[model samples]
Target: MQQPQDQTTTLQKTFRIILGVFMIAAAVGHLSFQRSEFQAQVPNWSPLSKDLTVILSGIVEAALGLGMVFWKKQRIKVGIALAIFYVLIFPGNIAQYLNHTNAFGLDTDAKRLARLFFQPVLILWAIWSTGALSHLTKKFKG
Candidate 1:
């Protein structure tokens, strides 16, 4: 009996939950066995040590992942924050490509460059999966 829009919203929420689980898994990688691989993605010029950057970002990702899963009333806000986090970390991806650092099996120039293009997709995924894009559009149109 759900309206079309309601069905779409339900799908979006489902996608957001999946994305949340994905984020949590990735955060575990950042903090555990895959830590060194993640360190290669940290920019060489970062003021913080690579390990610290990895650890801090891992913590943030875990928090954001949890928020996406449980903060229904604030999902739009969580989505926006997750999108911003994707944006903020993009420079590290860029640096990895530019420096030719090998990590996460992105061992070739082509692979690294291709990976660079996924950052925007992650940003969009975060926003879209939580209906934040629609919510923001309506807010701005008002």
Candidate 2:
């Protein structure tokens, strides 16, 4: 019998697809109707201007989303890349909470603070859904 790669369950596949679609939708929001709201997440300390950073990141998100949806041959790498992307952008999320910039309906301090907790979940989603977490763990155990 041909051994299966990744060995991902049906649920994981579904989660991967859903996360890809979510990313694509978020890219649309970043580029189109919700630009300013996204800008609220950019840190002022960024060397790039907020709009430029937002647009560039949106372009990257679109590419990553497309990869996640179609690049079955390299799902693990894509997942790691996406998780890193989440890690890199996390500071902006923090800045949003600290700066108290209102956007994305996270208006109150409690709401903003709560939203901070979701970043790790996104990171895990990217890793777990793509099977990168298992892949990396196996490599380390070798």
Candidate 3:
């Protein structure tokens, strides 16, 4: 018979897996729909070529999102990767919000503004699933 705590752990893991897959699908769809828009949004002075940057960002996001399903032992690493990805894309989100730019038919300032708030939730969700609780426990262990 399974203990209550064990059941909870299983549920958490299942939720994480589902969430990870959803994230990967969203990123893939974004790449398909807005690759060119993302490339144009890249700042010219940035070190990477726009094409390379957009493609690499898509690849990294897809990999990290998928990696969450199989990289249980390295959840912390995945969390870090996801957090960094969010930070890197923050500027583009901000630009969209500021300029009210309509790319790929996302022609709404409110939606872009909402994206600024929505992305942080993903960052938090990734951290929470990956190891935020464990990290907090360690801090309080002293």
Best by TM-score: 2
Q: How many Å off is the CA of 77 in candidate 3?
A: 2.3
What is candidate 2's CA lDDT for residue 69?
87
Worst 10 residues of 2 by lDDT: 1-10
Q: What is the lDDT of residue 66 in candidate 1?
A: 94
**Clashing residue pairs in candidate 3, if any?**
none
In terms of TM-score, which candidate is stronger, 2 or 3? 2
Superposed Cα deviation of residue 57, candidate 1 (Å): 0.2
lDDT of 3 by residue, 1-142 (tens): 2211221266567766876797687568557876788775566566888778777787877888787787776666676677777888888778777777776565788777877898888777776676645664665897
TM-score for each model: 0.92, 0.95, 0.75
Model 1: residues >4 Å from true position, as ranges? 1-8
Clashing pairs for predicted structure model 2, backbone only? none
Q: What is the C-alpha lDDT profile of model 1 across 8-120, one tens digit per residue?
A: 37778888999899889999999999999999999999999999999999999999999888887777778899999999999999999999999999999999999988989
Better of 1 and 2 by lDDT: 2
Better of 1 and 2 by TM-score: 2
Model 3 segments beyond 4 Å from truth? 1-8, 30-33
